[model samples]
Target: AGHSITTIEGLEKDNKLHPVQEAFVKEQAAQCGFCTNGLVMCAVSLLKINPDPDDQEIRDGLQRCLCRCGTQSRAIRAIKRVIG
Candidate 1:
């Protein structure tokens, strides 16, 4: 699978965040928030490739992320809301 890596700083124009980032904030999903941006981007990108992924597929998508934050479930829920 081919994927493009987009940094948190590069996700916008005029030095602003993308809407997905904004949405994550709105959901209050950013506790500590250290890994929030990367998690959000990863979720968005994965859903674009596999919109209706099963639980195991979602886990596979996140396998390389190595999250320290405990917001994984929230991120997965957001992706499912969009794609499912």
Candidate 2:
């Protein structure tokens, strides 16, 4: 296994959060936060594939990750913020 992996912790550099993380925080996208890590990871992966995804595409990209805290709307806003 010669694959490189990046976790949530690895997304930070120079004490600065990644754009996605920053957006998430700014939007208060995490309520309970139980699903925050997964949501963040999914968002990162989605953006990697599609840097400028539309609202529906963003929804579709994050659909696989479940957030029981009802923070999906905020998360979408955060992703849109990153896109902008």
Candidate 3:
């Protein structure tokens, strides 16, 4: 029960991927592409607080962000690289 929802199209404009979006593509993550945007947003928030998050920290961060395609593993990898 969140207050707002963000999407991939909303995350980018003028052909520029946000930092998290760039990280997502750079990591070769995202399968169905449904959760890509929200995942990226979550990544952004997480990185804002902890620029260097470990594996478990990432997994814990994304716990509530769900994807129908289940690309969690790939997303985690992307977040890790971006944070690092």
Model 2 C-alpha lDDT per residue in residues 30-82, reported as the tens digit of each score: 89979999899999999999999998999999999877799999999999999
Per-residue lDDT of model 3, residues 11-67, tens digit only: 687889877888788877778877776778788778878888889888888887878
Candidate 2 clashing pairs, residues 3+ apart or interchain: none
lDDT of each: 0.70, 0.94, 0.79
| Pairwise lDDT winner, candidates 1 and 3 | 3
The parts of candidate 2 lying over 4 Å away from their true place are none
How close to the true structure is residue 33 of candidate 3, measured as C-alpha lDDT?
72
Q: Please give the ranking of all candidate structures by TM-score, highest first, separated by commas.
A: 2, 3, 1
Q: What is the Cα-based TM-score of model 1? A: 0.64
- TM-score, every prediction: 0.64, 0.94, 0.73
Worst ten in a row by lDDT for model 1: 75-84
Query: In candidate 3, which residue ranges exceed 4 Å CA deviation?
Result: 1-15
